[model samples]
Target chain A: MSTVNLIYFSWVRERIGKGEETLELPADVVTIGDLLAHLKTLGAEYESALEHQNVIRAAINQEHVDHGDPIAGAREIALFPPMTGG
Target chain B: MTAPITVRVQRDDFDLAAEVAALTCGRADIGAIVSFSGLCRDEAGALNALELEHYPGMADAEISRICHEAVERFGLQAATAIHRFGRIEPGKNIVLVVTASPHRQAAFDGANFIMDFLKTAAPFWKKEHRADGSAGEWVSAKDADDAARDRWTLES
Candidate 1:
């Protein structure tokens, strides 16, 4: 199992009840979509946080990426809602 | 156009006049400068403040990238973007973008372009704090903001 550091922001952070965590990803979790799916299975908080998968934005290594992006070598992954910054 | 880009993400406020001056100091080639500042609003007296959350490493990096792109696209001499993260009260500053160029239009366009992209690209979010002590909600991202960013791709 590969380890991944996951970070959360905004409502996602609140719902998940933490700012960040380290997880052991099953081999089947190859992409961000897979990660989200696996996270939902972890608990109700994650499920509630990622209820709307479409609106959930992810960044690998601090760069914006899509759900289809691979997680092979990602040191960190951030999940959050659409940015409202200006 | 390859000048240094200044990007700051802090909890403290910034001085717009000082920022502008810092960019233009001893710059004989720059002819025009445009500055834009975004302030928090009370939303008809309902807001006590706005709690801003940001991705620590990514916020400044993303804005620097956006500023670099704006500098390249608009031929800007310099660009600086500052975004504050923390609880901000009504009439307090939230963001500042200043762009300098050889001409007025480039400076204006550069500043405009930075703000349009910054709103959608920066890794920051706002949560409202109501004055009446009610629980606040995260501010939803606006469709208009996405449209604003997309329009720039069409322009250039």
Candidate 2:
């Protein structure tokens, strides 16, 4: 299994209090849902910050993706908001 | 010509005239240069300024991409943007965009296009410093900002 880079931005960064981290996930675990579930165990902060699932947006390898997408063989996973850039 | 465009995120204040001169840099073929400066206003009866936070690397890259896209989509000559984060004084520049083109309309439209998209797309968090010496952070997204962004889509 390859290592996955997890990143949180904006409010997510504030809530997580860390910018980026690398983790090795179980082979069976894929998809953003699985990642969120795994992250929930990190602490109370993750649980509260991620309480509402829909508001959070995500991207795989810098391109935005929906929650249902699988993370198998993913290298970088970034969680952010509805992208407010111009 | 090799550089896609210039996009910068900084904490210190910027000099508008100097930056513009650098970009134009003896390019007399550039007929029009459009610029937009967003200021920290005292609109809400507040004494202090606003503090902004962003996703660092992502913010600049996204904004740069937007500028490049706008240039290609709208036929612009060149575009540049500078967004300042952290504590900004009232009446200081929050964001600035300059677009150059052979025609005035393209330059103007390109600058406006970038602002419209940036307001809604740039992943920046704003927290205002109040007169009471406290701070109030803006909630997730604003409807007006979304409306501005939607106009570009409608045009296409």
Candidate 3:
């Protein structure tokens, strides 16, 4: 098991009610998809924020990665809705 | 000589003329300078201010990376981008991108490139504050912005 720091932003943060958290990743949670699935089981807030998983974007160690990307050795991960910046 | 690249994500407003002058002043080689400033709009008089949020570290890194790419691809003499966060009233400046090159074409293209990429790639979000003292919903990502960014991919 590895401890990973998860950060949320924007509406995702609003839904989850927190900006960041630290959690222990089970061995089965080896990819971003798996992590998101595990997060969905945590509580209603996580499930609500991650309901539309396909629309959410993830960054592992500050670099954007696909959901299938492996999370091995990742220290930090962030998830948020698609960017609306200009 | 390679031009300097400046990327800043701050809460404070920036001075456009001063930024451009700092990049081009004393450099006779710069033949043209182009700039783009994004302003906060009232959204048809429905909003009092626009609140912007961003992922601090990633915002700076991503914007800097794209600015460098724009500078290299366009053969720019210099490029600078400044994005503001926090509550910005309607009519205030939201972002500034300035590009300088020996020719007008590169300067123009570089500035355009920076703006296009910044629209989609940067980790920033905007929420409207309605004029009636109600908090508006978070602004959703626009397909138009994604389309604008897509054009650059084909050209590159």
Candidate 3 stretches with Cα past 4 Å from truth are none
Q: Which candidate number maximizes DockQ?
A: 1
* Cand. 3 Cα-lDDT: 0.92
Candidate 1 residue B55 Cα shift, in angstroms, is 0.4
User: Candidate 3 residues B54-91, lDDT tens each?
Assistant: 99899999999999999889899999999999999988
Off by over 4 Å in 2: A82-86, B1-4
Cα shift from native, residue A81, model 2 (Å): 3.7
Better of 1 and 2 by lDDT: 1
lDDT of every model, 2 decimals: 0.93, 0.78, 0.92
- Residue lDDT tens for model 1, B1-156: 368689999999999999999998987999998999999998999999999999999998999999989988888899889999999999999999998888899999899999998999899999999989989999999999999999998876
* Candidate numbers, best DockQ first, in rank order: 1, 3, 2
Point out the higher-scoring one by DockQ: 1 or 2.
1
Tens digits of per-residue lDDT for model 3, A1-86: 99999999999999999999999989999899999999999999999999999998999888889999999989999999999877
lDDT of 1 at B46: 92
Report clash pairs, candidate 2.
A84-B120, A84-B121, A84-B122, A85-B121, A85-B122, A86-B118
True contacts kept of each: 0.96, 0.42, 0.81
lDDT string for model 1 (A14-85, tens) is: 999999999999999999999999999999999999999999999999999999989999999999999998
lDDT: worst 10-residue window of model 3 chain B: B127-136
DockQ of each: 0.95, 0.43, 0.87
lDDT of 2 by residue, B1-156 (tens): 532378899998888898789888967778888899988887667757676877767678778878988899778878889999888768888899989888899988898889988876666777667787765655457678888879888989
